[model samples]
Target: MAMPFFNNMLALLGAIGFWPSVVYFPVEMTIARLNIKKRSLKWLGLESLNFICFLLTLASASAAVRQITQALGQYKPFMYKA
Candidate 1:
């Protein structure tokens, strides 16, 4: 029972981690397929900046959740006091 729950959780995290890159790939491919050229550097730069921001945000949020869980674990004994 516990193993299945753990596996499901891991799978969920994997999907969340995988989606942004998966989404970016097809859109980039489609852009290339369209044969559009002579794009502005400003637009490309901004897109790259946005992608970096997204990855950082996800990473920070995951870190914060982990930290909160760790803190709760520390406080568990105190909660059981009579």
Candidate 2:
């Protein structure tokens, strides 16, 4: 019964929890702690990393949604297909 809501909600929750925790906060803290100058090479690199991580998270979430949709079509609650 809950399977329909499980994967997407899990992905949504994970992205909500992990995006800021893993990506934004750490990068912001690093910039503040080290005082990386704006527009400098190091700052650009860190920002690039931040953007990449964001892209990855977006990709993962989209993949989860896609998989959920695919499985939902093939699935029936409390039934076995294989």
Candidate 3:
């Protein structure tokens, strides 16, 4: 029933939550670091933007994980009316 939907939702959430950290942040940070080493003025702005993006990604990941955990905790096999 809803279990399949929840499972799919969890997978999607995990992908969205982890992809930034795994892919985007590292690449951006590396570029920023290279710019810094080269003494490029754009490095400052790039680093700042990277920081902001990191924070946003972190928040999203945290919320997604929290939601997944809450859903898992509240899951029930069956419900019966009293």
Each prediction's TM-score against the native?
Answer: 0.44, 0.76, 0.54
Ranking of models by lDDT: 2, 3, 1
Cα-lDDT of candidate 2: 0.83
Q: Which candidate ranks first by TM-score, i.e. highest?
A: 2
Model 1 lDDT-worst window of ten: 1-10
lDDT of 3 by residue, 1-82 (tens): 5473376476557657564766567757788666555446676666666666667767776766777778778666685435
lDDT: which candidate is best? 2
Question: What's the residue-level lDDT of 10 in candidate 3?
Answer: 68
Better of 1 and 3 by TM-score: 3
lDDT of 1 by residue, 1-82 (tens): 2232344346446646663666566556655676545356644754575577567657755765675565555553324434
Model 2 Cα lDDT, one tens digit per residue, 32-56: 9999999999999999999998888
TM-score of 2: 0.76
Worst 10 residues of 3 by lDDT: 1-10
| lDDT of candidate model 1 versus the reference | 0.56
In order, candidate lDDTs are 0.56, 0.83, 0.65
Off by over 4 Å in 1: 1-39, 77-82
The parts of candidate 2 lying over 4 Å away from their true place are 1-12
> Which residue pairs in model 2 clash with each other?
none
